[model samples]
Target: MTSPITTSSLPEELAPVPATAAPAHAVALVAEVQPFPIAVAGAELEQLAHRLIATRWPHRETAADQGPALDEIRALCDHWATDYDWRRAERFINETGSYRTEIDGMGVHFLHARSPEPDAMPLLLCHGWPGSILEFRHLVGPLTDPVAHGGRAEDAFDVVVPSMPGFGFSDQPVTTGWGASRVADAWIELMRRLGYHDWVAQGGDWGSSVVDAISRRNPAGLRGIHTNLPLVFPTEAEVRDATPDEQRMIAAAQRYRATLDGYAREQATRPQTIGYSLADSPAGLAAWIYTLFQDVTDSGGRPETVIDRDEILDDIMMYWLPNTGASSARLYWEAERDVSGAQVIGAVPAANPVPAGFSIFPGEAVQASRRWVERRYTTVLHYRQHERGGHFAALEQPAALTDDIRTTFRALR
Candidate 1:
């Protein structure tokens, strides 16, 4: 058998594209139109709400709590249609130094907040499924000016929060292979386009996967990587010697796959089929994503237990206004071939030899073990387990999440 590759001697197959191969001409950055007014008039919101209240829901079987729980759906719809304010959420995003630029033939929207510190570390942040650029809104002020938030200026970072292609203001790419690997390349190009050479990358969920791909490729001038979710598939030995807690966690994961993996299966296999429902009916869209927010988290109560109504609606609204349900879901459709094939290799084995850090939140799909993670990462500087947050760490625990980024990159600095 081939000996395991050392970090130093890892083959060039894992290396990033040569600098000469990178774009030579400074890509002309095209500015996007400033986003429209965020505040929906109270009367307009009321009218939409009234429509939801009077909505004609479809008939279902008596045993069909298998779908979104009716009570939960009704409660969420009521809050969204009546209580949620898009304008407030919009104003918050706008105030955070948001901007847009065209990259790889798509209009890429992002929030670029420079730290108050003159020598602040540059950081690229990404969000995942059922989320928008809005997820990172709370972390911007704290990250860019840590002193104001009762932290050291030395902990400050110049943060870049980009909406992934096919989501939010970013133009949907009409091509194949926009998976984590492709997005990682886009992010590297995005950083270079902004004239930054060295920077840190961070993400969770799909964002986590992209950053992982980016780090694995060891793109030039990349300082390190940080993620809320780590893809740590267990090895044969680890599985054989699993402890009860590990075993229990594995069982929970299996149960989640059985019940919750349907959406992924559909998105991966035939996103367009369900895309029609999501694109057309506001109620249908809400139910599709609302189930994940409810089931994926360890929230003591409902989604409101973790995310505010307006916040939740704001994320959903990104899909609504753009009608990106089909395009966004197509990401899974594109990735389906890999997920279904046994020939697929685990992401860690394919990892680039960069330093990595993790912040594990509750109710995530896979809570990887440190031992498992260390096998892939050359440097595992920080791994913290938080009691309060769930899968949507950026949204649910921005302060804690921001602190994690500050702490992780401190080692690199």
Candidate 2:
């Protein structure tokens, strides 16, 4: 079985978010949205393969159950170098009709797929750390055209999947303050610019936090939110008189904080420090990210049980090809600083005022009981507990996640 892992102990500023403000140097509302396609240079792919071949691995984990085993990593690396077809992944992304637009001075890259149905609800999907837009790749065609995927046309959506700033192809912020709150504002502006006056929002991991921020703002056009990673922590009262489920979750959260969160601490405290290794070594980047995938997927022991090795590499290619190791990690640094207070060991932020829905998968890094989630999601339209899936819910269980989106939003709509 995979080792147990926990969510990042990354700090959040307890201070209330201020009213959304446009950056002083914000681009005008009429900023351009240009068509963009994925095209990594030939030499870069060659260089990556060479690096994989030249890798010098660390000694095997003394605790066999701890982190990725040495042999496992070597096999993965071998597959990456010899059999992974990044070109196929590139074709998949390009076919999605991606685009880049300037929002509040930062260039935001997004995939905009309109439904064949005349009247489809507009939905925005956000991804988090170690994840690129590729996380939601499988859900796009299914979400945008449900009819073709064995669903009714009425369930169709005009989907918008944006790469978070500093992640994927989006322009990385040179200065600070691109935290959760700022990203929430940027997403609102993005939807507005695209002429979506009313829409729904969804995310997992850091994306859940971003969507939570959006729900808090209760923006004009945001209809509701559906999050897979429901960041809900029990109150003091709930803790004192915990249910069996709550006690189990509380213990798990504690174990995660104590044992499996080193990467988060490093990233939050000093992204640039680790960025060096992540940037210079493809194998290092793969190993770092692979650890999380291995520990967090619903797969019994191996990540490949749920996701294809090539698909996993495709997600990594977003970081390797763009050389976004430093930039992407900067997001944690910015977030930790922006949300200044020390993160309470096992606490969810305050309840969101807007309508919300949560899907808690079995293998999530952080687990929460329904009563705990209901406290924060005051208007919880839906709350589900699944037997499978994990932090990468969209990628691991696309149909389940997509169905939740459809079911949750259908009520709100």
Candidate 3:
């Protein structure tokens, strides 16, 4: 008779097996031999530029400054059609030891930068809406070699930057369940498959939600969690017993819901309908993503004060070339099922036992007060309020972000 396999007898590859063996982790992290090449040929980019230049823009009211100022859009398109360099960006990404692996029947692309330090902690960093793996580009070098960047080698981290499912090289899931919760499971399996029994997770935007799910679920071997955005469901007493700053923050959040959340609402409810408009027109796609960058900045009058034009365009190009505008937006659509319900708390606050940290950016929706975040997180080791960075903190202030990552993980160590 065949003997039943016990946990001790399980292969090292399955060292951190799931609660149920039925949820097998299929993806494997192959050994990194050399930097993976990504070639966005100059000619192809030129062709895209030509299409933009030839596009017949729709008419807008001359006096109307509503919804992505026409002049700003035109200027941005002109620069993209003329000055931007996709090849250079591709080279930058390739130089960082990027790679692709198949997970859950999807081809997932990620940047895997191993630390020179043998004892370095492994960290999985995720990005959110209107962002990509590119956000963490500057972070790879500093994180993998902290000593070289004015920090101790013990602060080093082996970083993994995966493009969320349906966002980049990762194949779009035909079915549902690729939401934050499912994505968290995929991330845990990814780390386990990579032979990391313990690791850290960090994210912003939709990534924050995914990180929250990972912590709440308390996946085996998760050491700690960090996020730029932490959504805490408020209680009646909390709302009733709010301070002036808390009340002001709540008001700002309410205003955001009223005005700025339309895209989210549509994405959450009718992504397919909205996707049709975004999938075809590159300019349309740029406008949609660009609007967010504009709305969520602390710049006095110019969005450029917060985000670089080329950097913003780089993120826009990911959506443009991958044709993921529609597919990626569907994540919001799938999330609506829970967000629209009367549960009040959206999804359950993760009951994660691991230590958690927060890096509060100035332009984020509303910085979740420490008291509020404490309700959901078991341990809050580090909380820093940035003076200037905005929604896209990784791209806007990479050096500062790298420092935060180092400081937070250093505490966990």
Candidate 4:
């Protein structure tokens, strides 16, 4: 069984988001997108195996199960070091056609796959922390080439999945202010650069926040958006008058904030401080990220029950191979400084005017009733509460997510 975990939950609603603005350090952006494939060297893989084998394990947790169990981690590391195939994961990435380009002084990497159908619409999929572009690896086929995945060609999409800065092959931001808004702006620039004049967007985790920013900007080409984790905070009055179901949602979130959010607190406050362990120790990093899968997935603390062990390893390798432990954690630090840049915890970005769709997974701690979401989105095209799935919806329930995305965009298309 996995330990109970809690992601950062919604707090008292804040002010509406401000208008989009360019970063002070904005520079001449490179007007080109270059091919950037995955090619990890054998020696690097060897080094990772050595590090895993050499990990100095901590003592087992008490029977209370506050975090990943010691025995479970040890076995996972053993398999990771001795039997895991990094090549399979690499093939999963390269097969989709990866590329990178300079946007506002940061190198952003992405996977672009065009659909075979002539009427396919441009679709941008954003992933958050602990999730790389690979999170959407399963959707590329179903969304881009629908006929092959037992779907109609009319539902096909020209999918674009980008590695949020500082996460995957993307370059880490040198200066501060690469917050959620900046990332959203870069995504807009990317779609435009690719000559996709009309497109829709979707995201979860920090990606949801980025999509929120993009919706606020309401660019001419952006037709609408979809989110699995919608960031909707009701008012004090609204809270007081919440329905029985809404009250239950509110209480669960409160419990999450009260006990299960230490990881978020630490990352928001001292990303660099925690970076030392996360960057240096492979085992430490695995346990830290693994807690979420346990706490959040419908698998009831055993993520491998739903997601493949190798696939989980693939997600971890994104952070390990790039040594992005510190860089990716800094996203929270930037947000806490001014309540800006990828803020998920108590952030109050302005309400968006674009039509939006929402899919709330039962395992997700932070949730909103349709009334709650519609108030903010104004034009709610689609809203669903699936009986299964979790925060990592793409990994846990790709088929459901893809179908939801296709369903939502069909109206606009």
Candidate 5:
């Protein structure tokens, strides 16, 4: 009796509900908040499946350590063509009810879930490159409704998870100047519009940098900050007088820059060059993203070793379906140039003004010594070294990360 709404014929109810009204404070700055849902067209999914089937794969790598193994790519692509379910990922976002709001003339997509607890603290979770709102999907329920997730009612948080510009459902930055610092400013404005005067910030990877920037700014509502991947490097003296662990970490960082940082370097310098391939070829996009997952996760050697194949595919789909290859990569260009005056570049970052917490996940890109971290975050309120989990802590060790967040902010709250 009824047919599904095609992408071309999307009804007003399902479309991006425009923001006709703006708060008093928001009027000065152009802003528009709209109710957004995660719904990719059925035809887009069909196209993705077809592209996966028609991939023009490269020859298998002779050196397994150099890149993703052939067998791994083959298996992943096979599943992408057959068993992967984009709807499941879409359903999760739909259930959570995401929204898109214009801040600084750029559209930002975020999930704002409130807790029943009257005294609940506001928590903002920012994700990095290759990570969307999906990174914190599992953590949302536990953070918002602590009682349901085996925590005290007082530990509840009104969580806000925003997709950085050019990532996920958020609109990509049209002009330049949308680096980490600009994004930080946008987050503060977002919370202000939501009527949150005080909140804590958390992130890993690029998210860590953004949180670090926010902490530096010491925005009106920001209480404290936490990061899984603390962006601190050893000082010259510290490096010279390194402990065995510090030495090991320094070596790892050096190796990463020399070898594993090609993708990053390319993105930083020439994202548009690779953008064509990334936007055109589904297989290329998967491989490009999968390589990072394989290298960063705590999974013996491959990302799938620690995380599920389907989970990885879901993350990949976020990039592929949205055609965000170029836009996402442009973040690196913005970071490299410090387009927004708020990027934490170089080896040693400046000290944070606000209080900070560090959850040092073992599989992070590089390990920083307490001395190194203290140099950047003078008031290190809480510090924990996790035995498991990697760069993608929320996906790999949600319970541990969640516990760390709760414990880190208990005093502040």
Candidate 6:
């Protein structure tokens, strides 16, 4: 019997693929990337002001933790209407960076920060639901210009933060099928379009899933991936034979799915239905998104205590300004019926052989033990647990996240 072609005697067809091999991209048309400096027309801001002012208030909840406190949201809205500056956020984004390209006829918006260092690494940052590229905004300075941010010049990265289609300033999808898998393809195409032949990616929330998807694709240019939330659902056996540490993680995830996941379920099953309330009322949208920030942050029920009120509002504006309350939720809708039958947007990850690293934040509801992570990521590069931070790592713990990214990729480089 003829032996299968051996690696030692491989012909051209059987030769190893090059490291820079193109990632699979199904899009039919890819247009030239253009400089898309964000500018929310003055009329748009006025319209938002009108919506915020016209909000119909809801009755107070008897229990404080039942949801966003009526007084809290009102106070937030009061400040949003009077003191918050959307123009400042707009100007920062415009001045620092902004770009958009048409992939499959859908406009993909991103912020590209080029490093001044000669041998800087290329990095892609992804964000998830209720989050815009805004999550990674703070990362621009330290990551792209590490020396200026109290880090070594060797750690500088050419960072690309993309607003997943239907979120932030990116155009909403006109049809169905914009799931994690498709977003992964688009991200790969994005890095390629920008001429990044070798690079790494980082993500949290939905961003984790995108990075997971890209890893599974094992595209040529993708050198490594780092995630704050790693998907390591212990097998039924692992659960049955759980260690003390493993049990704690499993229990934490169980508690989250039982109590804190109502919003996810609503978004997953009825994005359109929820979209109506979210799209029409600024107050409704803020409360909906705020519930997450409150529940997931390490702030002990007060997200504003941990994250700046203005920054929180800025994140909310990403959805409110673009009217993405409904559109962005569609990703959850697609994911519920998605890539792997076993993923929770904030819990699970794509299984792959790509060199992988993970940073577990203590307050993040969904997390895996080191063994679980090691089992899934065949080529584990780095893994560590942090004392603070939550699901919104980029926003809640930028410095730690930055340090972890630098450490993880240093080995790869």
Computed on alpha carbons, the lDDT of every model, listed in order, comes to 0.73, 0.80, 0.74, 0.82, 0.80, 0.81
How many pairs of residues collide in each model?
A: 4, 4, 4, 6, 1, 1
Candidate 4: RMSD over Cα atoms? 10.1
Candidate 2: Cα lDDT at 343: 44
Cα error of candidate 1 at position 84, Å:
1.8
Most TM-score-accurate candidate: 5
TM-score of 5: 0.90
Please give, for residues 84-166, the per-residue lDDT of candidate 3 as tens digits.
87766676666665555555655566777778888989999999887899878778888888888887888889888888888
Q: Model 4: how far is 156 from its true place, Å?
A: 0.8
TM per prediction: 0.85, 0.90, 0.87, 0.90, 0.90, 0.89
Better of 1 and 5 by lDDT: 5
lDDT of 6 by residue, 371-401 (tens): 8887677788888889899988888899999
- Model 4 lDDT tens row, 149-185: 8999999998889988788777777688878888999
Better of 3 and 6 by TM-score: 6
lDDT over C-alpha atoms for residue 269 of model 3: 81
Worst 10 residues of 2 by lDDT: 2-11
CA lDDT, candidate 3, residue 238? 76
Model 1 is weakest, by summed lDDT over 10 consecutive residues, at 1-10
Global CA lDDT of candidate 6, please? 0.81
**Which lDDT value does model 4 have at 54?**
87
